[model samples]
Target: MERIKIHFAYDGTDFAGYQVQLEKRTVQLVIEQALAKIHRQDIKVFTSGRTDSGVHAIDQVIHFNTPLTLDCSAWRNALQTLLPIDIQIKHVEKVDESFHARKSAKEKIYRYQIINQREYDLFKRMYEWHVIKPINIDQVKIAAKRIEGTHDFTAFSASKSNVKGDKTRTIHAIDVLEEFGRIVIEVRGDGFLTHMVRIIVGTLVEIGIGRRDQSCIDRAFATLDRQVVGLTAPSHGLYLWKVVY
Candidate 1:
């Protein structure tokens, strides 16, 4: 079988999520439908990971096997003609059969956006988490620093997440930056559990607003309890910013 690799981006607002459900609209379902139109058969695709409902992915990677031979450009254009406007085919290429999208990924960067101002901006309503209270950027920075290295992040993930086994993941860096009336939190990590990045943002936001302190991060880790952690941030504000292989 010939393996083809694809790099794609999606708005993720109108769809259910990345993975296909029985009836719900999804990125995978639409892509596969488009592939079916071209290949004249069902084509199974494997993604790096599934994004929750309303979660956006800027560069979601996937790989699929095909029996027919077609150039990279031909595949890209053909898929685009069948896909909806919300999804875009960024790049496509033929890859070695050994390259598995999920297993081969080395890093992923997630971005969460929050509007720190009190008044809400109608234009940014759908894309950002609007925070009415004042946030101390310095406090947010302090908490971000504490969890920069490797640790078992069991406390920072959704308890009901289907992903099981080791909760240990290395966080390469977390940068808290303010720009254009919004606060952006970017986390680079080797891997993430369900709602992992959203949970991290929620924890930091709590500290910035004085509801929690840096100690909570430690307590959550030491106890390995989700109850010690902050609420999971809204899904719309989170984005799978990048994936590195």
Candidate 2:
């Protein structure tokens, strides 16, 4: 058997999520289906992370062990040809048998985009979250600074999240950048709880809109109360930017 690593990207608007569901359409299911068709066997692929519904990915990585002895490009080309239009395999490399995509990841980067405008464009509606209210960019920055370093982030996850083990995670950095009328919130962390990045962005958005003060950020963290945090920003605006190993 040979272990193969695949770098891929997908527009997640149409699928349920990255995990394989029994009945619902999902990214993992689609990829497995395609791989099954191409290789004439039931091949299961392991991903770096499970992205929720409506989330996009640019540098998502995955690996699988296969019995076939084909070239790396053969696997990539075959999967691309069988997969849907929204998903594409960027690159494929043969790795050592012990390589595991999820466990080997050192850091993951996620970006959430907010359209700060009065009106929305048709083309951008499905890709970006539009916040029409006036914002204080400085407040967003202030809140972002507090996001850096190691901390327990239980307050920034959804109530329905079934995150097992410890609630503590280290955020390497958080950056807020404005580009072409869009406010982009980028977060780099070792790992994230369910909806953690979106909740963080939502809280920052509230601070930007003056609904919540910068002090509220500390309060939420200290209390570990989900109710006190900002809403989970829509999944459409969130993207899994990369997984650094």
Candidate lDDT (C-alpha), each: 0.91, 0.91
* Candidate 2 structure quality by residue, lDDT tens digits, 7-93: 999999999999988899999999989888877899888899899999999999999998889998888888899999999789999
In model 2, residue pairs whose N, Cα or C atoms come closer than 3 Å (at least 3 residues apart or on different chains), thus clashing, are none
lDDT tens digits, residues 132-156, model 1? 8899999999999998889999999
Candidate 2 TM-score, C-alpha based: 0.97
Candidate 2 stretches with Cα past 4 Å from truth are none
Residue pairs with colliding backbones in model 1 are none
User: Distance from true position, residue 92, model 2, in Å?
Assistant: 0.8
